[model samples]
Target: MKVAVIGTGYVGLTTAVSLAMNGHQVIGVDLDEAKIVKLRQGISPIYEPGVEGALNQVLNSGALSFTTKLAEAQDADVFFVCVGTPEAADGTADLRYVYSAVAAIEGMQQAAPKRRIVVIKSTVPVGTGDQVAELLSGCPELTVASNPEFLREGSALADALAPSRIVIGAGDPGTSEVVEELYKAVDAPRVVTTRANAELIKYASNAFLATRISFMNELSRLSAALGTDIVTIANGMGLDSRIGPEFLRAGVGYGGSCFPKDTIALLQLAAQNGISLGILEQVRTVNATQPVWFLEQLQPFVPDCRGKRIAVLGLAFKPDTDDIREAPSLAILQALEEKGAAVYAYDPIAADAVRQKFPNVSYTKTAEEAVQGAHAALLITEWKQCVELPWEQLYESMAQPVLLDGRNAWPAQIVKQAGFHYVGVGKS
Candidate 1:
């Protein structure tokens, strides 16, 4: 299959690289000349585990390439629209990027009379595929399918290569079959459904996961008020067959590119339909307050942080990636700075990016260097390196060996044995 992936953002780039690795010739199109140049040099713009290697392999094999021209897509068998659909002020998705990408594809379709399969891999509102179809009605030879992607940030390559399921939603059965054939080599459950259902699945999955995180965070508050340990309670509950645990860990709420935005968009969608999504609205509210609550918990130990040095470990939303968009660590850093604290932060991969965002704040090359001379340390993201750091070494470097475990990624007993006072969410 000769595939043209439009918008070489995270999803589009990953999809192109993955498909190329699976023996398809892929051409990734993007308007940014600099980005296309970097991709041509076999460099990935985003930080995703295992993606660079796969992309390098495909580029070396002549299986994948990047271009800035839209006409290059005319000969492709499939065109995947993987552009951004950022959240607007009204909580609806801003579809300007998607529409722009669609128009570009429409122009290419006009030049080529052969029918092309256009797949929507971007997360969008329901009926968006129909809108794309309606826009391309003039061409009369294009088929649009809703095939929303479910790739996580850090593990995008792995998710794309080995997805849990492949969903194909189309108005035409023949078009859906053609899209299905593209993933025939992938051993996963295949779901054939309507375009609306496919679009809703993406939103519903993200919203439900966000809801679970909010529910757990809310429960953490109650557990703390009643002198109970959330970890113990969660562990016991997870043992039940009916209540399997995944996103039940209590923390500083869920903040990422997907969860926060999708939850709000879904709630707004319900409101526009004249229905109340009270639970989801509360979920958003709870998540919004979680970071503040985390800051409040640290106040008792560092009441007057003026001129005090504080070490922040982890900047990305999660581990193995340098993506800081909507990361709780950013809010925590801002709050700490507002309290007159001199913040020193370090992450394995996110240090330089974080420095770019917060130039005034101090950044260190190593986690120990960040911890050195700090009054207290806050473990924000659950990076494996941060989780497995030598607590004794960190304690020796810190002026005050008080630790706030935001993600609860540390062993409390070990930290205490290392002569540091440890604090974790929903734990005494």
Candidate 2:
């Protein structure tokens, strides 16, 4: 399969690289000249584990290429729109990027008529693919299929190479078969359905995962008040086959490119349809306040944050990625700064990104550097460097040995024995 992946963001690059690795000749198209140039030189613009190495392998093997124009990939058998559909001001998914990609593909089809599947791998609302199909209805040779990606940020490359499932949503049986044939090399369960179902599945999956996190977060509040361990409770609940342990960790909250925006867009979509997802509404509420709630735990230990040196560990939303978009650490930083706390933050990769938004907060190279002489330390993201530490050394160096485990990644028993005042989310 000669695949053309439009947009060189996380999804597009990973998709292009993975497809090329699977022995398909792939051309990655992006409007950005600099990104294309970098890709041409086998340099990945994004920092995803194993993607750049795989990209270099494919590029060297002549399995992959890069282009600034969609016209360069005119003869491609499959066109994947991996563009970002960012949340609009009104909370709906801004589909301008998607529409632009589709229009470009439409123009390509007109110039050189051929059988090609315009697959919408970008996350969008229900009926988006059908709308795209209708827009290109004149071209009988072109097929529009919704193939939503389920790539997590930290392990995006791995997820793309071996996905949990492959969903192909096409209006016609012929289109479905063609799309399925494109992914024939990948071994995953297939869900061949309508375009609408496929689109909704992407949004619904994120929404449900957000709901689970929020549910546990809200439960953690109860656990905190009752002096019960949320971790133990989660483990006990996970023992039941019906309630498997995933996204059950009670943390400050989930923040990333997906969950925060997707949940809001789903709510907005539901509102437009006159369907009130009250439970999901509450889920968002819990998430919005979770970081603040976690910060409130600091009050009992340090009565006033004024003139206090607070060390914030991990600035990224999650572990590996440098993406600080919608990261909880931002909210924590804001609150700390507002309360007159001299903040020192450290992330192995994401500190530079956060430094742009928060110049006042002191950024450090190492977690130890951030916590040095600090009154308290907060674990915002559970990066290994941020979680695992020289307990005795850190305890002796801190102005006050107060540990607030927002993610509950720190070993409470060990930290307690080390003579640090450990305060964890729902850990008594």
Model 1 CA lDDT for position 39: 94
lDDT for 122 in candidate 2 is: 93
Which number leads on TM-score? 2
Best by lDDT: 2
Question: What lDDT does each candidate get?
Answer: 0.88, 0.93
Per-residue lDDT, model 2, residue 409, is 96
Which pairs of residues collide in candidate 2? none
Candidate 2 error regions (>4 Å): none
For 1-428, candidate 2 gives per-residue lDDT tens digits of 89999999989999999999888899999999998999999998887889889989999999999999888898799999999999899999999999999998988899999999999999999989999999999999998999999999999999987899999999899989988887789999999999999999999999999999999999999999999999999999988899899889999999989998899999999999999999999999999999999999999888899999999999899998988889999999999999999999999998888889999999988999999999999999999999999999999999999999999999899999999999999887
**lDDT for 82 (candidate 1):** 92
